[model samples]
Target chain A: MGMTFTSNVLKDGLSRIQREIDAAFDAQLPVPDDMSASLVEAMRYAAIGGGKRVRPLLVASVAELHNGSREQAVRAGCAIEAIHVYSLIHDDLPCMDDDDLRHGKPTLHKKYDDAIAVLAGDSLHALAFDLLASPEMSNDPAVRAELVHALASASGHKGMAGGQVMDIAAEEAGGDLDLHTITRLQQLKTGALLGAAVEMGAIIGRVPSEGRSHLRNYARDIGLAFQIADDLLDVEGDEEAAGKALRKDDAAGKQTFVTLMGAEQARAQASALADQAIGHLSAYGSEADILRELARFIVERDR
Target chain B: MGMTFTSNVLKDGLSRIQREIDAAFDAQLPVPDDMSASLVEAMRYAAIGGGKRVRPLLVASVAELHNGSREQAVRAGCAIEAIHVYSLIHDDLPCMDDDDLRHGKPTLHKKYDDAIAVLAGDSLHALAFDLLASPEMSNDPAVRAELVHALASASGHKGMAGGQVMDIAAEEAGGDLDLHTITRLQQLKTGALLGAAVEMGAIIGRVPSEGRSHLRNYARDIGLAFQIADDLLDVEGDEEAAGKALRKDDAAGKQTFVTLMGAEQARAQASALADQAIGHLSAYGSEADILRELARFIVERDR
Candidate 1:
């Protein structure tokens, strides 16, 4: 069943979302025939042709479960992906993570200059909110406002960015961070955006806050499993398959789930978490099959 | 009358807005007792106790002219100011403008490390939309969405960031950019946000798109005058009073309004534009007196 799910539903969803995200960015950012052309080009270069499109997939799958509009879900997914891509671009900057490769291509700062990279990242950050707030995202202004608020809160200082600060500090702390500290860091850094991805789908589905506990729990579990799997990948996964540098955590002496727990324990923990994540959706029948498959894939996939 | 306006109304308005913006940042971003403290501190450092608070003042004044609530206008103003402050932080990065001083102090990157500066700016960028879409900004969701849309549009690739690209291109083109191109650059770079400042205020007051022509014209005229005055300041103003490095445009061999038209002509154009900006507000009587004074003050102020 897991193999069938990966080859069918999840595969179809990923490809469809990848195409939708590229098309959305292509349509939204037409390079002007003027001096500012390079800025738009840089934005397109970084945004249009990259990444797993996982956030969009999550939004689409969750929204589908709720019988929400596919178009609106895709649009919202694009907004979330924009924020994700922008964060990646900034994180790869020379002063940040100093990454050279992203999605098997040169990082934005390496491809363009640092100034263009910064501006492009900033533009994408603004573009996310613009996409969310635009009338085309949803006819209902309340829905649009809610979407903007959710993305903004998740992306801001107390969420993704704040988590990054903790990650950096963890690196400087020389791998002394405990399990609780590291878990808090990952929750803010990666967990907030992932949680928001599920929450946003629920928002599109008109699911109230009080009714989203199961989905939230599912997201939380998957988020940690995803991070733990990423740590395992850094230690054992192929750089070619990952399409980027790996083992940098060990080089930087950063304390990660694998570093603290050892690979065997971390891998076991990830599998357990993935199973827990899948169980959270027991309330639904096969309608949540893709989500359950996603949980399995999170810990099982090479990348 | 102009003297009375500046010393009384505008003066009070400026100080009041400065306090409001500072207080808003202080209240919104309390430093956490953890590793993320530096990130929040960096955001607060750059956002508080800086600049002229011109954007906030514009929002407050225009919203008042439209009989909008003071508190709501102030909140919206803080959002605009956040965007402005974030732009400044990014612009001052070593990879960008490489400036050392801003608002009479070390730039964000100079004060904090480059990575923190980048994250702080990105966080503040998210914070702008967060503030705009928050329930406190407006009771009507449509209004909050409109505010977010207006700001996001003004700050993205085709707007402020786009203008920055053109400005960089102009520098590479070696002071040969035509007046039309320069005007277009300034329109996007500075004019867009200035225009959005008034547009947002009108949005807060529930002014429909069709009803904002006069205000749009008022904003447009003042926007140009503001940039021209900035160019003049860069040429002849005291760096001490300006609180930033001046004459750098000339050093970079960039074409500015003053460079292209000569200081005398640029000064004349700015004064004319200011008058033209004030003339657009002729529909209102004493209710617009502050705005009229602001227009005059735009071209007349030394820094």
Candidate 2:
């Protein structure tokens, strides 16, 4: 019954973050009453529809555990999700992956052409900062500045952008990238933002630096687990559930966890990671129950 | 003699900003020792090289008038210039303007491929915010937060991105957009960043909000003048000097200040605005001298 209750709360937590993120976009980024309407429309198109909401869930969960304000956590969630969506739009461009579908619909580039899509992504990136800078996110300006800095460090050249460059180079070079390098790349590319998400919640709660380290450890475990799960999904995820192209990494000769360690080992590693991630939270009590369940769910989920 | 002295200071001011901005890029964005090297190279490709360095100059000039720290001003200048360079890189994307060259060199997309170009631009955008959030930019965290907020407001949907949408829409609609709409478009597209440059400089100096209005007015006037001059350059500038395609705006049949007011009238309007812009700084004595000269030069410059 205790496990069931926590799972239910985790489910609600996911949906709540999704709703708040959607509303945050609508409330903050209204469609302009002119030709700029299309730009906002494309931003809305990318942001609103659907995703797993994992990043936001992490933010909200950690914030709640620390007794941070719900509204602030929700707003932070929107900010991180905006960065994630913007990245996907850029990633799916014609010169990038050139994918046409996302979440079972035509990608922004496919639906609205390339120019609008580019501006839309650029605008969403701006919106993330705008949201974080707002009073809704935090009345404390220092916290706000820290959030902006952390997000940029995670998402910019030093982090996601840097990792993306390495990803592209790996593909162009055409060989099996070493496991160590692949792990580092994934840490920068995906893990940085994921770590930022948890760190943001810690900031929201005013968690001490010593306390923050444990959260960071938890974030790192989940981040690696999430990516390993993604690699596993690509290999075996159902097309309908996954809602995007899959198994392309192997076809493209890209290095992935599954490729380096084999599918079975990768799955085992993901499980170990998820368990360790939950272990880091042992200090937090029942207040962190939802985070614990979510960790387990992340490795087990099909999509 | 006073006017000549001011002009010389203005010249050194411009060169100082150029050198400082180039050095800022070098110092802040060191290339990693991996595949990310190419991404940093692409970012360098776009951010370095020749351009007027107008935005940074505006920032430094205004900052100096307010007695802001020179080091702080140069850092702020780099932040704004980072945003400007990022904008150009995105603007030159094949899906947008299809530009092959910029500042007499190959565009990022042309030189590094489209994916690299997009990520480089995105990374630079992130770098701009990161720089603003840097400790070197300010010791006060609140000031850093305000800088981030102001830059985002000026560059985001309600600013550059919003203006870009209307511009594309104006072309797609295929008609003479009304003068009112054209003015609004340019305000968002070009004017916003120019205004932000001045506002940021004022912030760097810790100028009170009331003390900042004159700078705001000065910025507004110069922003309009800058765009009109750009329109003039398109009609009459040398391809070798301008370092990019020109006359394309007219060829595209888009609504522009020059098109609406005629080249002669547009030139006159630019001169009038430049005069008004200079007038806004009568309060600052010799400290304002460089800003006044810079305003006049903006309209008179060939490129």
TM-score of each: 0.98, 0.97
Which regions of candidate 1 are displaced past 4 Å?
Answer: A1-5, B1-5
Q: Which one is best on DockQ? A: 1
Global CA lDDT computed for model 1: 0.91
Docking outcome class, model 1? high
Instruction: Quantify all predictions' global Cα lDDT against the true fold.
Output: 0.91, 0.86
A105-156 in candidate 2: lDDT tens per residue?
A: 9999999999988898999898888778765567788888888887888999
Candidate 1 Cα deviation (angstroms), residue B271? 0.5
Task: Specify the poorest-scoring 10-residue window by lDDT in model 2 chain A.
Answer: A1-10
Model 1 RMSD in angstroms: 1.2
Query: How do the residues B39-71 of candidate 1 rate in per-residue lDDT, one tens digit apiece?
Result: 999999999996788888889888998889888
Model 2 earns a TM-score of 0.97
Candidate closest to the true structure, highest lDDT: 1
- Expressed as tens digits, the lDDT of each residue in B226-295 for candidate 2 is 9999999999999988889898987888878888899999999999999999888888788787888888
